[model samples]
Target: MDDTFSPSRHGLGHSTNLVGRPSAWMASPGFNDAPVALHIWGVREMNPALFTMLDQAETLAEAGEAFLAYMVAMFGIDPEQRDAAPGSRKRFRSSFLRLIQGWGFDSNGPEGAVLKGWVESRFGILPSFHKEIIPDTQGPVWQAYVAERMQSRFHDNAILVQLDLLFEFCQWAVARFAYPGQSHLTLYRGINAVDRHGILEQQSRRAAVIRLNNLVSFSSDREVADCFGDRIITTRVPLAKVLFFPGLLPSPLLRGEREFLVLGGAFRVSIEDI
Candidate 1:
């Protein structure tokens, strides 16, 4: 049982020496002005073996499985605990199976439909792209559209709760091991407060603009790249340190402004004296 639970055996060996540092980007002037909440982490280094495993995932299902395995290892969940814990194995199995089934184009598949349904039922919005009009030759266009829609709907408490879970997971991953480098792993989590009315109005207008743009740029056999001159760039940062919001509560700094409830502080396992 111990062997099955060992992180080292599961490719999560402790090699990277991660140290947490304050985020300079979060402290930059006017950084907090954006009407959105965000949590950013500055990972100085990551375990090469872990990266290898991540790279090996060929599909979303595989990636989901890998994620579950990593989480289990990181949390040091033994076999017995995994079996005994309510819904532990079931949750992992469901997610893994769902990922394997795949979220199809424009979320037409079961998983995507379910996700869309849940979001719509909870938040009263559904992400839709006119497949007949906009030739989503580049599959990611619709995916991006869905992501944007979800981001705009972040004002819902249910969505915020979901975000909290995601944030907690990241915190747990960072806490589990250290990166092999001089700098430490940094995790930044915050919510950007946006005016609900203003954002919805803007989103509606943006949809119109996108539609008009697509019509003008339409070509029967257009490649995704030519149709949309967009490229994704990835970057890695090693070290950074800065601090803002001196105390835990942001109320002191945001007295007259709209109040924002900070949720999900740094994730740690500790006992508190009641």
Candidate 2:
């Protein structure tokens, strides 16, 4: 499916050797804080092939599609069993790994090598997910179970849950990489955006200050309705030309032509507004 991420030595057969170590991937903040990781591998070593795919990808949509395909090949739950096990909430950590391998990652197989190479060449040699590393840890199962939950709750819009994960990665990057003084970074998956409510729910716990640019939009009106109804905490800054529906933002604080609403939860109103 990923022509760009296809292994260069495709005919040479798959290699079982996981080239790099998982400990190296631990550099990411997820490993430090959470008992489990978000993705199968680390981000340090970008695979030549994966990079090539990303480079050739024409538009944002195409890039996102390609990424989702990769995610499916690595994570998406079985469609048949998708609705079979209902109302089940599993751990995030175990679920994440199981999703990756469930996409068909085996240590012994031809496709395994190809997939591993695709993974390694794209993301770098991954750390061996040895059973010992997480011994006796009841870390939550992440992606797969989450995907299942989304599918059950939202039905056709299952991708929204995964999108939230991608944006969550962006948030993690901002929290960890951005300079301490740069707290004003824009929240790409904003609070008011309907589709972003899932992400905003997660962000409410961590971020105190966030930026909302004018360019942001969502997938559906229902998403917007879901957003406001969720009772998540966040503030929105309107762009110069843009104006949100007054009903959508019940607590609007207008400054000149633009409105800046402080939907209070974790954050207090600024002195100027107070």
Candidate 3:
């Protein structure tokens, strides 16, 4: 129990209406309960093989290879390419570092939708943005997200599951050494409009309960985050919920930025206007 978030409310803010088996899509009942659902999906229980590799591996590079191999065997994501085929939504090959890079390219695009959808299913956190605001799990925003997620999977069949691996690995590594005694990453995110994000509860003018996009990129470097927008919000993201971090993977593509890709739920964050 990270004291930053209290279990008093027991929900993730507002729940969106999904037609079919709700558990398949949204694992937890509400905003605060999202973390509770992760109990069952702890990679050790859900995926022992991957967890073992992350635990026993000596180097990050070695762990990264085993990580990719798991995806290759499980999803048939072979013949790794750097990027998806241009305009080919029906098929894709860039699944290795796909989720992050593709997401960095366009969070509202096919890759972004898939990543967000995966978070919703696994972590029970819904996406905050997909071309527009997604207040609830119904209507055009949710429909568009579902369509985009399904379409992107045509490229790499198990890309969504592959992302699950990414999260598990990040948690394993961070646990070993995360600023010692800190379970949350001290990260910053810059946004042009805080209103556009889902502010579930307004604790104060400077702080609020914000429901973030399921898979969101944040910067460990405050100055770098400031470059993205005029308003800045900094928060403590639980290490268990982090998906990707700088140097977590050996790929050169991730070397350029001090960014951490965090799985989002409703967070009590402090806002500062630059």
| Top candidate by TM-score | 3
Poorly placed runs, candidate 1 (over 4 Å): 1-33, 38-67, 70-93, 104-106, 121-124, 129-208, 211-274
Off by over 4 Å in 2: 1-41, 44-48, 75-274
lDDT per residue (tens digit) for residues 131-183 in model 2: 11111113342222223333333333233333334333333332333222342
- In order, the Cα lDDT scores of the candidates are 0.26, 0.27, 0.62
**Of 1 and 2, the candidate ranking higher by lDDT:** 2
Q: What does candidate 2 score on TM?
A: 0.26
Ranking by lDDT: 3, 2, 1
Error of 2 at 185 (Å): 7.5
How many residue-pair clashes does candidate 2 contain? 13
Q: Which residue pairs come into collision in candidate 3? A: 11-30, 11-31, 11-32, 12-30, 12-31, 12-32, 13-31, 92-155
Q: Which should have the higher TM-score, number 2 or number 3? A: 3
Give the backbone clash total of model 3. 8
Each model's Cα RMSD = 21.5, 18.1, 6.3
Clashes of 1: 14
- Ten-residue stretch with the least lDDT total in model 3: 1-10
